[model samples]
Target: MKMTRFLATGVSVALVLAIPNIVTAKPEVQGQVDFFGGDGVLRSAEFDARIDNSGAAEGRMIFIDPSAAAESDPDGPGEAVAGAQGLLIDADFDCLVVTNNRAVMSGVIVDSNTPERIGRRILVTVEDNGRGRRSPPRRLTWGIYPNQARNWTPTDGELGFDPGAGTSWLASDAEREDDVPVPSNRSEAVSCDSFPPGSHTLVDIGRDDGNIRVRP
Candidate 1:
């Protein structure tokens, strides 16, 4: 009888130790960005991101805006807008994996000409109502904005900022007055398939050359 009791206690301890591993298993997701331009044509951009079970995320996104004169004037002087790449650091993802299917990432936009030139730090918030489910088709909404108080310029890196000033560039009147469509109306939604748990592969969708894909 004592031998059986000892064996039962050992099994209980083993089960207790294994429970944490199962409970701590991280939930991750991967997806890309596809949105319509001002001309109403769908444009695709590449983005891959993942969140650990602890709600920390590390990922990258490449933004490519199609040339406005591509179709109308093939030999025009204006070229397609250069691509901008952003790196995701230790951004918060708890809200996404927990209650709300929303995640916000903060990172810097690196310069295209010189890879080391950090142009500006920005915030990107994404929300998916379908939670990556396939049947309903996951709908993703994205918003982008500057996170710093300084203004961005092509020549001068980042300029005009007062540390002690109470003004915020994100909420400044100048930003609101700007008529640029990309920054002003940054929010857009696109349908995508669900990403299953433990899956770590790239999924591509949309047009041929301007396609978007998410990679592990």
Candidate 2:
């Protein structure tokens, strides 16, 4: 009787241990590649990811390109040329589906030549690209421009483009409105077999080499 009871207890413990695996069947992680760049030059890049745990060896991959630019004036007595504008994907991962997580983001141009000047802007969206979830990729081109033209005068006057959102064209009857989005900052990774001369300087992340552009 004692042996039988011990065996029954062991079986119960084994079943309990297996319950987690049975309840949450190891999710098959699926990843893929999505192209994001310009006509000839690359602007930005991102990789999609999905996993089961914080350190799961298996996961999915999704990538994208998020790029933009800024304009500043010349130095001292001159206008400050706007720095680079766009999103810098440091690293992102939300613990829960739509809750707590770490978003490592740095959206600004870093003067590769002078690492001193950095542009600032709030752009980029975190979208769902896994399993059976489908939603708008989340466009953030709104509020990405100046409100009014910054008059570039010497005698203590604002001299620069207005700061507002999405101004393909300036406000009514506004002058000197040249808020064109240029792709100055290139990706830090690219394929050697596919890159050309005088393109962006490639930076190696992990086992992959990408392109990097100086935020002008």
Candidate 3:
């Protein structure tokens, strides 16, 4: 009887220990951003992502591209900025990774304005740089606006701001009045898919301003 009781207790303890190992902790990453684009065809873009560990991501992204000349006549009948167009992309985020205060998200373009872009892959990263810089740019220039150029020109795939740390740039009245797009500096790369999805690689694309939280 004593032996049986001891065996039963041991089995119960073993099951409890195994439960933790069997039940893996899944992480969640979700966030949204509304910012400008420095280069590329993107004039400005916004992303909203709500993704869970089950590989289901619900979000959408919209970007504007103004190929027309500046000062397209605000009172014009057509688009305020001539030749400017907005593109939409419905994304499905299946992978996410977070480190420190930054988050990297990866997904596929389930739908897009460009029909041929459907089913393409997409990845992005965002960092909460607190509020922003205390002193904003009085004016925004395509190259370096003397805001915080890091004294170095961004390479082809380098971030607009310093990768290690820096506050995000907010558009000043000068830039806004100038009709420049949201992102003026080359603060971020195009994507974070270079590393394996879900890796703790934080590549902050220079977002204008928004909020993003990662529970991972």
Pick by TM-score: which candidate is best? 1
> Which model, 2 or 3, shows the larger TM-score?
3
RMSD of 3: 17.1
The residue pairs found clashing in candidate 3 are 36-183, 160-186, 160-187, 160-188, 161-187
Evaluate residue 151 in candidate 2 and report its C-alpha lDDT on the 0 to 100 scale.
37
Over 23-115, each residue of candidate 2 has an lDDT whose tens digit, in order, gives 664322111223233243333344232445443422111222344333344364455444545433222322112112111111333222222
Error of 1 at 155 (Å): 31
Ranking by TM-score: 1, 3, 2
Candidate 1 runs further than 4 Å off: 22-29, 33-38, 46-57, 67-99, 111-118, 129-135, 147-216
Query: Candidate 2: where is the Cα deviation over 4 Å?
Result: 1-3, 15-44, 47-67, 70-124, 129-216
lDDT of each: 0.41, 0.30, 0.48
Against the true structure, what is each candidate's TM-score? 0.41, 0.27, 0.40
lDDT of 1 by residue, 1-216 (tens): 999999999999999999998777653445566765345655554555565655566556555444322222235556533433322322222222222444444445554332322444434444443423342233333333333353432332353664434432333355566653333322222111112222222222223223222222
* Between candidates 1 and 3, the TM-score winner: 1
